[model samples]
Target: MGDIENIDNLLALEALLQVTFHNRSLLLRAITHHSCCSETALRDSYDTLEFLGDAIISAHVVEYIYRSFPNASEGDMTALKSEVVSRRVFALIGQQLGLFPFIRVDIANLRTFNERSRDSLCADVLEALVGAIHIDQGAEVARDFVARAILPMVEQVSVQADTNPKGRLQKIILQRTGSLPRYRVLEQSGRNNDRIFLVGVYDQETLLGLGKASSIKEAGRLAAREALETLQKQRGKASIIDVGDESQPQL
Candidate 1:
C-alpha cells in the first residue's frame, strides 16, 4: 500500500491504540518515516521521538523485570531484559497492533518488510507512538500503552529463557568461551513474502553451525541449536572442539 494523502485520517488508529492524541499532529508525525518526508518538508519524522521512546521503553522494561521477578537473580534479570527488551519484540508488537497499515512510508520501501529484520521500521513507529503519547498524554498514559502493548511479551520471554535454542545456546557459549555467538544471514531465496533465510552461527572466528528457515530469527534458533548439539557431541567425544587457524568470515 501507498502512503496516505492526509494525516488527520487517524481516528480508526486512535481507536485501535486506545489513545486519542489531543495534538493529532504529534501522532501523525509519529508514524511518518523519513523516506516519505523530504528536506524541505515542514513536518518532522519519527526519528527524534524514536530516540526518546527507546529510553522510555528500556527503563519501563527494566523496572518491570525488577518488580515482577523478585526471586530472579540479578544475572537472570539482566539477561532477560537485555535479550528480550529489543527492537524485534517491539516490531512484533507493532505488527500485532496492526500499526503497519497506518505508517507513512514510501510505497517502494513497503515490501522490504517482508524479509525478516532484527531492527525494523515498525519498531520505530511503535516507539515514536510511545513518545508521542508521553508528550501529549504524559508518563502515566505512555506506561499504560506499554503495559497493554508490551508487558505481555515479558512473561513469554521469561518462560522461554531456558527453552529457546538461541537463549540457551547464548548462555552456554558465554559460560564456555566467554564470547557470545553472532548470527549472520548467509543466504536468501523464494518469492515475495515467502522468502527463506539461511543464517550461520559463529563463535568469534569459528563457524559453529548453520540453519535455514522462513525468517532470520528462526534460522538463528536452528543454528544455535545445531551449535549446541555440536558442542555437546564434541564434548562427549572429546574435551574441546578444535578451531584450526583460518581467516575469519566477515559478517
Candidate 2:
C-alpha cells in the first residue's frame, strides 16, 4: 500500500499551496484515488475528502466574492461564484498546477484516455487536496489556501465562462438584431452508449449553421458557435467592402 513516502509530489504541492501539512498521511489519503487503493486493499481514498473539500471551496469562494465585490449585486456575485467553482474552471486550474504529473494511475492504457480525461482526473485530485488541507489544518487555512491558489485565476475563469459559444451567439443576436437565436433538432442516431445528435441554429426564418455531437446540447452549442463565426466573418467582409467602396474614385 502507498504511504506518505510514496507521494513525492506532495512536497512540491505543499510549496505551491504555501501550507505544510501536520498530518502527511491525510494529504496522501486525499490524493489517493479509489482505483489505486482498490487493487492493494487499502481502506483510505480521496472520495470522502473530495466531498468535504467541495463544500469548503464553495463557501470560501462565495465569501471571498461577497466581501470583495460589495458594490456588485447578489445575482452578479452568484453568477461569478457559479462560474468560478465550475468543473471546467477547476480542471483548468489543475492543469495549470501540473497536477497530472503527480497523479498515481495505472500505467497500462493510460495513453488512450487523452488530455480531457487526464484533466478531469487532475481536477478531482485538486478538490481532494483541498479537503485534505481542511482536515489537516483548519477552515481558515483552507480558505486562505483557496484564496491564494484560486482567486488570482478568477478573471481567466470569468472570460472562459462567458465564452460559451451558444450563450455568446444568443447575446450577440439579441443585442444586434433584437431577436433570439433558435435551435432545431435535425436528427438523432445510434444507441444509448454512442448516440449522436445533429442540430441546426436559426435566426427568425433563416438557417444559420448546422452541427453534430454526441449530445443534443453539445450539437446545439456547436451549431451556435458555427453561426457566430459565420456572422463575424460576414460582418468583417461587409466592413471591408464598405471601406473599399468609399476609398474608390467617384465615376
Per-model TM values vs. the true structure = 0.70, 0.70
lDDT of 2: 0.78
Per-residue lDDT tens digits for candidate 2, residues 134-179, read 8889888888888877876666655554436776788888987899
User: What TM-score should be assigned to candidate 1?
Assistant: 0.70
- Tell me each candidate's RMSD, in Å, in order: 10.1, 5.0
Where model 1 places Cα greater than 4 Å from the true spot, the runs are 1-8, 40-43, 109-113, 116-119, 162-167, 170-197, 200-210, 213-218, 225-251
Task: State the RMSD for candidate 2.
Answer: 5.0
